[model samples]
Target: MSWTCHLDETDVQEYVGRVLGTGYTVADVTKMHGGAQKVVYKIHCRNGFACVLYVWDLTKNYFQEEIANERVHERSFGGHSFETNNRWLRNHGISTPALYDLHTGQDRYPFDYALVECIEGQKAEAYFKDPDQRVRDEVLERIGSMIERMHANHRQGYGKPDQSGNPRERCHLVQLENAKEQLSYIVLHNGSIRKNHDRLLAVLHELESRIDSRKRYGFIHGELGPDHVLVTDRLEPYLIDIEGAQFFDIEHEHTFLELRFGKHYRYFQQNGLDPNRMLFYRLHHYISLTSGGLKLLHRGFPDQVFASNLADYHARNTLRFMEEWQLDN
Candidate 1:
């Protein structure tokens, strides 16, 4: 439940005044792009301090259920969770945003805001088509190395690192149910309904049989796409938007990155990792992505234009998966 919050300089100055103190004044508060469910702004203070501000939109929640802290309809944990995850990543040698301050709700404003140290860089996707092949290859290798470092950390269970003690059964089961509901909706309405439905179910069953519940899991960004990877002028890659960090099968993480970059799959793969397992997870990921598109279409939560675009994306994934399935068989 989130809504747009249009904040002027006065609004930001007042908010920062309350959080910081009287001496500090906001010089500029510029809204950044690519916040699907939240409003992001780069706040610069007259005192030479700069930070990234995240204002949680209370009209729509990103997680299926409210995360860590929920006060009525307001989401309190959006910032805290990311702050926690960022600390974990930093401790494990991952370059991420550094948290400065987090406010749930104040008398002046009634929403969440987290201020973190801003990393100066353009999105890594900006370099995906560089004319210089050397530059492109170097960036890809660096990205691959960063992912490998993150995957190196092992955990005993499969769940979010921040919520380690809690029973993951609840979260895990909820995901399975959501996936089924979305897949079911597409099967009922789309032209490629029957084949998609059957294939998705078969892939799920295969996943269940192939996965070893006893295997150790590792931390994964869970949402590492080209847009999320930022490259500084120095060629360093910083992963951002890590609010819901979780530990899961490392291979699942690998498959997703492979899907995005396409060329770095072999670079990250270790010896003895079962190819069958990787293929199954890749299939499952595509199915889930397609299902996600269908779910968006049904909800119309993000509006009709966005929903229509997503449904089209699902159509594209459907065709690609069909071709891959044939090669595998």
Candidate 2:
């Protein structure tokens, strides 16, 4: 679970030279700021051209069983799927970084890497931080429109995309089971939640029934939020870290957007989403995040204090989701 920089300056320069012709030299490679799990390096080219390079983080803190499955499926061993998803979205008129080159690490680089056109813009989180309400609202509107368009590209099943741009049906059960497992982990670790285990399990069972019986599925950014959106000076929003995206209930996505932004934001006003299922998925997402942090805590990866704070924050949010569900009832 300890991820360190595997590629050095020389490796990057050589890779850039190979990708961009002999004259294009890498002047600098600086780590870019983002919440993504991959190591992102902004490579400055001599001719004023810049590109972003991402190396897969192999040392992810996953459960032992999860790691075994990942190895069997060869997940994160290369950037082919990442390129595929990016190209699929770009073909559908979504604004995303153009892929320049992808190396699976079997050829040259020591790790799987992707070189893509660098986008010049501030992350949407910065806009949210702005004191001006007008700026925030404007950005919110743009984000909402983008989300709608992304949802327009749908598939038959629920999960990650396959070669045919359809959801990988094999991942559907795994995704649901994983959610249930995370909820169980949360209940087992927290004393307060343990007392209400029966109630929580009943709610989860109901939510699972609702989700499993649904046939509607749409392409969605699984982790859509301000942090994942980059807004240019012209206010154009570009999405990043789309590897986790999949075909799922669009209403689930809507709930995520509302939670990240505000439920009263103009975006939610534009559409009517099933509030009950939305809140159910909201708790699922919240618990998954909190559980991931707890796993990190168990592995001694992130600083214990930071991990504790993160788990606390998400736990509070999860409780709020439960309260909202009760109120609706």
Candidate 3:
């Protein structure tokens, strides 16, 4: 059974004092929601200072399984990944939260933690609900451009930010194998997935044959969604939750954009993308999400409703996409 590790008053007080120096007393620590892999707290200081604290602990991670070798492209749940990715983005002229201090040792806390600059803004997801169309359009344009900039930064190799040199295998084949593993996991855990397992596998195999080999790769946010973007009062957008940022097939990033951005994805859409890669990546994304959601549910993630809904939504989409693909073919 999994459980969330929350820091007590003393824990927060000492950490804050050490990081922020003297005269910074903790007024309150609000546990932020929507994070499944790590514990995040918005720390408000008695002296009107505010910052965010991130704790990476096994107890906080909802997924219980060991990290698979094929999943090295996307890494998270550690201070090292966060710190490295933060510096990489900043060096590349991308906007990310400034790191105030980072503690990787186990002396202070059993888990790694970091103090970061708290971005004072609403998530780009919130802007979608605005009554003004122009407001929505402008935000979309800025975010779309920011992503384009990130994608334009090319790399010879594909992997996590800290990984150097080329990968041993092609990106698509690696993810295809990972997709099969995810589908198998989903089938075992979800009754709904079990019922349609064969059909899903058939669709995946059909898509696999259409994929073509590619050499060049681009830097991508790995999981760029409006929710991962924070828009300041001045309308500037900053990418957050950036540990997964890496160089990879741009198609993988676009596949996620289409899923997360939904109708607004058109603003960020670009030409010259390979159609075959897009279709293959789309199926893989659905299977991956379904498996991840089920893993969270089985391991007793804190938000039961979110976990259940995530699994159901993606599992249904997997079946729906299969049926749609079959009909089109």
Candidate 4:
């Protein structure tokens, strides 16, 4: 049976009424974009109050069943991870959407859900497209500083915020294993990966050998990009989609910033980053994206073009990185 849960106007209205208290009827409920594992809706009340609702239902999840089941601790999902990471960021002075209410049990609904403050601002990604260069620079600078502040919060061990106990495997080793698994899947599904499988694996192992051990891990929004940031009128940035927040190698986050920000990444660059780790993580990231995009396509994600493009783009990037590594050696 397909697990997709399609919420109608009445369903959203009832949910809004319950969360917002009596007498405030829902004026509108508009579905928002960018949720792959959850459903998001922007709720407008008759009283002019607005908020965002996140519903974590299995029907909306597009991950391969095995991956979804196995990587439960790695990927941020459900109300528990959201609330835990939200509180952690707020406690550390990082800006994130305010959580108004959360329900992890199915007594109220069939799945976990939460109501959060609706940030009124453009996404940082949208702002980066402004014709004004100063506007772009200001946005980049604010994001850079905010990220720096987050990374400054250090931890002795690394893992998701909600994960307990000392990890048995080194962070880099675990990441390498993840990359291998992703690449293995990509090779089976993607023709491009099949052709370049050996070269890509060689590049991954080559970079892996160069990595050195580290004791400190920095707090990071695991999937941070401009789109994940909401900028207010005053130009202050608030992080959204923050369930993946964790203490990990900050280099992993920088690699993603470089990919998402493109030429604008210079503004978000950090000093003292281990070059080897960055290179390794960069390759691993492309592999992960390639695998994830393919999985989404296989699982019938809503945006077929997006899934195909993401998979193709990252697959090409993986090959390109492999060629670059060969030239450098």
Estimated TM-score per prediction?
0.80, 0.84, 0.91, 0.92
Output the lDDT of residue 207, model 4: 91
Q: Which ranges in model 2 have alpha carbons more than 4 Å from their true place? A: 1-5, 34-36, 60-78, 108-110, 131-133, 163-175, 210-212, 263-265, 268-270, 300-306, 323-329
Clash count, predicted structure 2: 0
Q: Residue-wise lDDT of candidate 4 within 1-329, one digit each (tens)?
A: 11223455676667667877877687777778856867887877889999988888876778637436555456677788889999989988889999988977687467888889999999898886789888888888999998999999887778776666245435788788888888889989888789988888888888988887777888889888788999998888999988777888899999999999888899988789999999999999999999999998898888899999999999999988888889989
Candidate 4 lDDT:
0.83
Worst 10 residues of 4 by lDDT: 1-10
Candidate 1 lDDT tens digits, 90-118: 88889887777777765566666777778
lDDT of each: 0.67, 0.70, 0.83, 0.83
Q: Report each candidate's C-alpha RMSD, comma-separated, in the order given.
A: 4.8, 4.0, 3.2, 3.2
Clashes of each: 9, 0, 0, 1
- Model 2 clash pairs are none
Q: TM-score rank, highest first? A: 4, 3, 2, 1
Stretches of candidate 1 off by over 4 Å are: 1-11, 17-23, 46-49, 60-77, 105-110, 165-178, 194-196, 264-267, 295-310, 319-329
Error of 3 at 225 (Å): 2.2
Put down candidate 3 lDDT per residue, 1-329, tens digits, no spaces. Answer: 12223666777788789877979998877778647667788888889999998888766677535443425556655788889889988998889999988888878568888899999999998988889999999999999988898899876778776788365546777777878889889888788778988888888888988877666788888888888999998888999988777888899999999999999999899999999889989989989998888888888887788888988899888888888999999
Residue 239 alpha-carbon offset, candidate 4, angstroms: 0.9
Candidate 2, residue 257: Cα displacement in angstroms equals 1.2
